[model samples]
Target: MKQLVIAEKPSVASDLARVLHAKEKKKHYYEGKSTIVTWGYGHLLTLKMPEDYKKEWKTWSMDTLPMLPKQFLIQPLPKTKGQLQAIRQLCQRKDIKEVVIATDAGREGELVARWILQYVRYKGPVKRLWISSQTDKAIKEGFAHLKPAKMYDDLFYSAQARSEADWLIGLNVSRALTIQYGDQLSAGRVQTPTLALVRKREKEIESFRPKEQFTVELSYQGHPLTSRKPLVFSKKETAEKVKAQLQKETAVVKEKKVKVKKQWAPLLYDLTELQQVANQRYGFSAKKTLNLVQSLYEHHKIVSYPRTDSKYLPTDLESSMKERLQAVAKEFSLSGTILQKGKVQQRKVFNDQKVSDHYGLIPTEVAPNISRLSQDEWKIYQLITKRFLNLFYPPYEAEEQTFVILLGDQNFQLKQEKVLEQGWKEKEEGVSSLHLSLNQELPIQIKVVSSMTKPKSRLTEGQLLAQMEKHHLGTPATRAEIIEKLVNIQYLERQGREFIVTPKGKQLLTLVNESLVRPELTEEWELHLQKIEKGKEKKEQFIQKMKKEATRLVTEIKQSEKEYKDFALTTKKCPECSGRLREKKTKQGVFYVCSNPECHYKRRKDLKVSNHRCPQCHKKMVIVEGEKGAYFKCQSCSLTEKIPDKKAKKQKMTKQEERRLMKKYSEKAPAENPFASALENFQVQD
Candidate 1:
C-alpha cells in the first residue's frame, strides 16, 4: 500500500517526490514503490459565501444582512475545481494506507490542507511534515519523523476561527455600508482600523498650523557649536533678546570629555523588519518583498522560512553556525574573515525562549548559485546574507569628543566623533585639526535662523508596516495582504513612497462603527486568536464574540444618521450604458470603472506596463496610444520617449514573439505537461 503526501504547491510536490523516489509521474500526482505525492494550488477550498447558504442573502439588502450561518461550509474555488476533483480521487484510493499533510508548516498553511481534506470528507489516517527550510537534508529529516496530524489541531482551529470571524464582521458590515450609503464602500475588522490610522494622520496634517520660531547658536573659527539636543525659543522676541545678549560674550571651554562609543549590529530579520527595510531602501511594496523572499526560501532553497515573527535563533541551531557561515562565505568574500575569529556567537542573536514559529531569516546549508537568481531576487538574497553574516562580527567602535563651552552663563556644546575601529562597517567622521584645552577662550558668533514648525510626515509603506506590527493588527503573513486590499479597493493610495487617504477613505471613517475603526479591536481579537492557537482559549468563544460584534455593527449602519458621497465619480461616461465612469487606481495602473451598479462597463486608462524599460530607472515604461503616436512614459521617474514614426503603422505581435514573451514571464512547466521535462533538464547532486 502507498502513503499519500499532499503538498501545498506543485513545485513543492516535485521536491518531495524527488526525495521519496516517486518518479512515476501521473496527471496530478507522482507514484513510487510505497509513496504517492500530490499537491494543492495554495488554497483550492475556501469558506462558502453567504449566498451559497441562503438565497435571501444573494441580494445586498439591509434587512437580510448580518448573515450568520450556524455552521460554516466549505466549497472549492472556481479556478481550482479540477484540482479539488483530483485530490478527492486520490483520497478515495483503496491502495492508500495513510495520508500526509506536507503543507507549509504554519497556521494558514494548516488551513490550506485541512480545508481540502474536510471538503473531500477524508476519514483516513493522516500525518504532517514540518520543516523550516526546503533543503534536501531538512526534507529528509522532516519525513523520517512525521508527526500525527492530530497534534496540530489547535493551530487549525485558530486558523479557522480567524477566517470565520473575518467573514462575519467584514462581509456583514461591508454590505450594510454599501447598501445604505449607495456607494461601493468596504470596511473590515482589520482593514477599517488600518484605514483609520492613515486617515487620522491626514487629518493631523490638514489641521496643523505652522508657527514662527527662532533659535540661538554660537560658532567659532567657522565651526558651529552643536549639541545632541537643539536649543529652541518660544517666540522671536525671546530669541532676539538672547541673541543680543550673547553677541558680546566669549566662549570659555568648561570641560573636555573623550570616550569610546560602541554599537552592535541590529538583530536578525523577522518578516516585518525585512519588509520594512526592503520598502525603505528599494521602494519595494510589502507584497513585493514578501514574494521575493518567499521565492528565495522555496525555489532557491538558500534561505530559511520567510513567514516568521522572531528575530532570534534558538540555542540548538548554534551548532550549525560554521556550516551556514561557510556556505554564505563562498558568495560574500567576508565569510572567511568572520570564521577566522575563534568564537562568533552573541547572546542577543540566539535565545531558546525568544524563537517562535520559525527562527529569524538566515541562509540555509545549500550553497547558492547566484547565476540562477534574477536582479530583484539577488538584491533580497544579498540583504539576508549580509545580515546573517553580521551576527558574528564584532561591535563597531568610535571615539567621541564632547566639549561644553560657557557663553554669557549659557552652555553650548560641540561634539565630534571619529572612527576608532571598524567591525562590520566604518563610521563616517569629520574632526577638525584645531585642538583646544580646558579654560581656553574663543570668540562667540551668534546667528538667529527663522523656521516654521512642521507637522508629522505621512506614513510610508514601511512606516505603516511598523504601525501594524506595533498594534498587533495582523500577522507577518497577512499584513501585506491587508495593505494591498486597502489599496486595491481605492480607499488608500501611494503617492511616491507615502500613503495618502482618498476622498472615499475620509468618508469611510465617519461611516464605520466607532469601535470597528479602532486598532484596539483587532488587537484584542489577535490576542484571543493567539490564545486559541496555544490552547488557552476556545475557538468557539472567539467566533461568538465576532458574531455579536458583526450584529452590532450592522445595526449601527442600518440606523446611521450620516451620508456617503461617491467621491470617485468622474466626468467621463461609459459608452455601453452612458453611466458615469469613476476613476480607479489599482495595482495594474489606472482604469475607468462604471459607477452604475447594474452596468458592467470598465476600461483601462492606458497606463499599462510595456516590455521596454526606462534607460535611467530600469523600470517598465508605459506605452500610451495618443493622437500623434504611441509614446513610452516611465511611471516611476516620469521620463518620456516619443516615437512619431510609429503613428503611420501599428505593430502586431507574432506567434514567435508571443511565445518568447510567455517563456520569459511564466513559472515552471505545467504538471500535466509531463514531469519528465523537469527531471530531464535539472538534476540535484546534493
Candidate 2:
C-alpha cells in the first residue's frame, strides 16, 4: 500500500520530495512507487469565528459575549480551500492505506496537520515524521523510524486548548470592551498582559522624579578609587566636606585580593535570544529577525529549526558534530580550528533533558552558499555559525583584583581585571593588569562629581521580548507577532528604538480587569497548557477553566463603571460626511477616520501635496507614504510615481508666487479646468 506524507509548507514539501525520490509530480502532490507527498500552506484549517457558530454573535454586543462554545468548530480557510481539497483527495486515494504526518515538529505544527485531518475525516492509520532540520540526511533518518501519530495526541490537545482558549478570551473580552467603550479595543489572554507590561513601564517613566546627587572620586597613581560606602549624597555641601577630608588625608592600601575567574561562552541561540540579539545589534524588529532566520532555515537549509525555545543540542546529536563542523569549515575559519582540536567537551551545550521538541538553532550538515542569501539572512547565519563554533572553544579566564584603600576614617575600594587566557574572548580585547603597591601611603587627588539618579529607560523591542520570555507571556513563535499586533492596533507606537505606550494603550490598561492584565495570570495559563501537553492535566479541565475565566472577565467588563474617552480627536473633517475626523492607527500606518462610525470614511495621514506634476493630469501629485517608502499619487487621474527618496527635495514657493498660483487655479471653474475631461473619465469608470 502507498503511504501519503503531509508537510507544513511548500519549501519543506520540496525538500521531502527530493529526499524521498518522489519524482512524479502531480497537481498538488508528488507521487512515487511507495509514497505520495503533499503539503499545507502553514494552516489549511483554522478555528471558526464567533459569527460562524451563531447569528447573534455576528454583531459586537455585551449580551452575546462570553462566547463559550460547547464544541469549537474548525473550518477550511477560505483562501486555501482549493489546497485543502487537494490534500483531502490525496488522503482518500484508494492506494494510500496510511498517512504520515511530516509537518513541523512543534505544538502549532501539530495543530496545523491535525485540523486538516479532522476537517477531511481522514481515519487511516497514521505515523509521524519528527525531525528538526530539513537536510537530506535528517529527513531520511526521520522517515526511517517514524512514530505513531497517536504518540503526539497530547501535544495536539495542548495546541487545540491554547487556540480555543485564546479565541474565547480574546474575542469575548475584546468585544465586551469595544462595545462598552465605543471604540475598537482589543484584549487577549497573553496580549493584554503584555500590553500591561508596556503601560507599567511607561507609568514608571512618567512618575519618576530625578534626584540630584554627588559622589567623590579620587585618583592615586592613575587608579581611580570609589568611596567605601559608595554613597550618593543628596546635598552638595556634604559631598564637598567629604571631598575636603579625602584630599587632606594620605591614602593607604588596607587590603588586596586577587583571584582567577573563568567566563564560559554564551549558550546557543534559541529563537527568542537570537531575535533579541538581532534587534539590539542590527536595529531589526523582532518580526524582521524571525522572518530572516526562518528563510535561513527553510530556504538555505543551513540553520536548523528557527522556532525552538531550547538553547541546547540533544546528546544524540553529538555524534554528528564532526560532520557538521566539516560542512561549515569552508565558510567559517573557526570550524577548521575546531575540527583540528578533535572532539571538544561541553556538557552544558549538549543535554537531552534541556531539549524540547527541537534542539537549539545550529548549523545543519548543509554548508550555506552565502552568495545566494540576502544580507539579512547571511548576518543571521553568521550569528548561528559563530555561536556554534564558540561552543568548542575554551572558557575566558581572567584575574580579578580588588584593593581596599583607607583615607582617614573612610575606606575606598579599587578594582582591576587582567586576562589570564583570552579563550572564547580571543576576538575581544582584554583588560590590562594594574600595578599597586601594598601597605604604602600615597598622595591622591580628590574631586567631587555631580550626578543625578536617572529614571528607567523605555523598553526596546529586544527588552520587551526578554520580558515576555521571562514571564511566559507567549511562546517564542508568537511573542514577536504579539508585539507587532499591539503596534498595529495603535496600543503601542515606535519612537526610534523604544516602544511608547500611546494614550489609547494607557486607556486600555485602565479599562481591562486587573487580573486579566497581570502577566502572572497568563503565565499560569501557559503552565497549565504545558501540563496538558505532558498529559498531567486534561484538555477538558483547561478548557473548562478558560470558559469560567472568560465568563468572569466578560461580566466584570459589562458591569464596570469605568469610562473610556476617545483620545484620538483630530482637527480634520471627513470628506464623505461633515463630521470631525479622528486619528486611527492600523497595520498600514496612521490614517484619519470620520467620527461618525457609520460613514466609514478614511484617508491616509501621510498624503501630502508634492511639487511633482502628474504626466496625465499636469496637476501637482500627492505624496503617499507606506511601509516600504513613499510614492507620488495623482488624485485627478489616478497616476502613481515612485519617489526616489522619502525625503524628496520640496519645491519652495514664495508667498507672492503661492498667492498668484492659488489665484490662477481658483479662477478656473470645474467645467473649464484643463484636467476636467480626464477627471470625468475616472469618475465614469468608478
Candidate 3:
C-alpha cells in the first residue's frame, strides 16, 4: 500500500512531490513507487449560503431577516469542483494505505484540509506535516516528523466558529441595513468596527477649529533651542514682546545636568509591524506589503513565513542564527561588521514564550536572487534582512545634556542630545549621530514662530492596522483584507497614506446597531474564539451567542424609526425601478444605483477606452460623449480628437500611402492606431 499526500496548492504539492521522489506526473496527482501527491487550490470547500438551506430565504425580505441554519453545511466551491473531484478520487485508491495533510500550518489552513476530509468522508490513518518557511530543508524535516491529524482538531473548530459567526452577523446585518435604508449598504463583524474607526477620525477632523498660536525660539551657541516648558502664547503680541526682550539679554545658566543613555534597536518585524513600516516609508499599502513579503517567502524561499504576529524567534531557531545571517550578508556586504562581533547575544528577541504560530520574519539558508527581485520586493526583503542583523549587534548609546536658563523675567529650559556610540546602527555611521557641545550663555537670538492649532490628521493604513491589532478586530493574516474590503465597497477612500471616510461610510456607521459599531463587542468575540481554540469553550456555544446577536440586530432594524436620506440622490431616474437614482462614486468611476432595495439596477459611468491614439504622444485615448456627440480625448497629452461622423467630408489616400500603412500597422506602430491609416479607403476631415 502507498501513502497519499495532500498539499494546499499546486506549487506546494510540486515541492512535496519532488522531495518524496514522486517523479511521474499525471493530470492531478504525482505517482511514485509508494507515494502519491495531490493538491487543493487554496480552499476547495466553503460554507453554504442561506438559500442553500431553504429556498424561501433567497428573497430579500424582513420575514427572512435572520436565516440561521441549525447546522451549517459545506459545499464544494464551484470554481474548484473539478479539483475537489480529483482529490476525492485519489482518497479511495486501493493502493493508498495512509494519508498525510500537508496544508499550510495555520487555523485557516487546517480548516481547508479538514473540510475536504469531512466532505469525502476520508476515514483512514491520517498524519499531518507542519512546518514554517518553504525551504527544501524545512520540508524534509517536517515530513520526517509528521504529527497525528487529530492533534489539530481544536484549530479547525476555532476557524469554523469564526467563519460561521461572520456569515451570521455580516449577512443578516447587511441585509437588514439594505432593506431599511432602501439602498445597497453593507455591515459586518470586523469590517463594521474597522469602518467606525475611520468615521471617528473623520468626525474629529470635521469638528476641529484652528486658531493662531505663537511660540518663542532662542539660539544657544548657534543651535536653535526651544523652551521645554509650556511657553506657547495665545496672542502674537505677547510672543513678540518676549522675543524682543530676550534679543538683547544674555541668559544665566542656573543648572546643568548630564546623563548617558543606551538605546536598543527595535524588535524584529512581525507582519503588522512590517506593513506599518512599509506604509510609512515607501507608501506601500498593507496588501502590497503582504504580497511582496509572501512572494519572498513562497516564491523565492528566502524569508520565513510572512503572516506571523510574533516579533521574537523560538529558542530552537537560535541554533541556525549564523546560517540565516550569512544568507542575507551576501547582498548587504556587512559580514565584516557583523562577524567581528561575538556570537548572538540571545537576548529577549530569542524567547520561545513570545513566539506565536511561526517565529518572526527572518532570512533562510537559501540566498535570494537580489538582482532579479523587483524594486518593491527588494525594499521589503531589505527591511527583513537588516532587522535580523540587529539581533547580533550591540545597543546604541548616546549622551544627553539639559540645563535651565533664566532669560529676564521668563525662565527658559534647553537641552542637547548626541550619540556616544554607533553600536548596531550602521546606517547612522556616516551621518551626524554624534556631536557634543558645552553649555554657554554668551549670545542670544530670538524669533517668534506663529502657527495654527491643527486638527488631528486622518487615519492612515498603518494607524488603522495598529488600531485593529489593539482591538482584536482581525488576525494578522486577515487585517489587510478587512481594510481592502471597505475601500472596495466605496465606504472608505485613500488620499496618499491617509484614510478618508466617504459620505456612504459615515451613514453606514450611523445605520448599524449601536453595539456593532463599538470594538468592544468584537473584541469579546475574539476572546471567545481564542478560548474555543484552547478547548476551554465550545464552538457551538460561541456560535449560539452570534445567532442571538444577529436576530436582535435584524429586529432592531425592522422597528427603528430612523430614516435614511440619500446623499447621492441624483435627478436622473433608474429605468428599471423608476426610483431616483443615487450617484455613487468609487475608485473605478461614478455609478448610478437605484434607491429601491428590490431593484438590482446599476449603470456604469459612460466612459470607455478607445483604440484611437493621441496625435501628439501616440497613446490610447478615452471615448466620452459630449454636447456635440462622442469624441476621443487623450489623458496623457491632453489632446482631443473629434470622432469622425458620417456627415464629414472624406478623402482617399494614394497607393503608396495605403502600402505604407499596411507595413506600419503590422510593425506595431503605436500603442493604438496611428493618425493615418493603411486602409484602402478611410474617412478624414476636409
Cα RMSD for candidates in order: 11.4, 11.7, 8.4
In model 1, residue pairs whose N, Cα or C atoms come closer than 3 Å (at least 3 residues apart or on different chains), thus clashing, are none
Please list the residue runs of candidate 3 whose C-alpha ends up more than 4 Å from where it truly belongs after superposition.
224-228, 244-249, 340-342, 408-411, 427-440, 574-579, 582-604, 612-686
Evaluate all candidate structures by whole-model CA lDDT and list the values in order.
Answer: 0.88, 0.87, 0.85
Stretches > 4 Å off in candidate 1: 220-230, 234-237, 335-337, 340-342, 433-435, 570-596, 599-686
Regarding TM-score, does 2 or 3 come out ahead?
A: 2
Q: Pick out the ten consecutive residues of candidate 3 with the lowest summed lDDT.
A: 429-438
Worst 10 contiguous positions by lDDT, candidate 1: 425-434
- Candidate 2 per-residue lDDT, tens place, 340-416, comes to 76464455888888898889988999988878999988888889988887787788887888899888888888888
Cα lDDT over the full model 1? 0.88
* TM-scores, one per candidate: 0.85, 0.88, 0.86
Return the lDDT, model 1, position 463.
92
lDDT of 2: 0.87
Error of 2 at 680 (Å): 55
| lDDT, candidate 3, 1-686, per-residue tens | 89899898998889889989999999988989989999999889999998899999898888887989999999999999888888899998888899999888888888989998899989999999988899999988998999998888888899999999999999999988987887789999999999998888888999999999998877666565556576589998999887787776767776667899987877889999999999999999999999999889888889898889899988787778767777767687765756555257538888888886788898888988878799999999999988888778778887777766777766665666677887787644332332334345546677888899999989999999999999999898899999999999889889989999888888888888999999999999998988888789999999999999999999998988887877888888888779888887766678787877678887666567889888899889998766677789998877888888766848678899999989887884433444345452465869
The CA lDDT at 515 in model 2 is 97
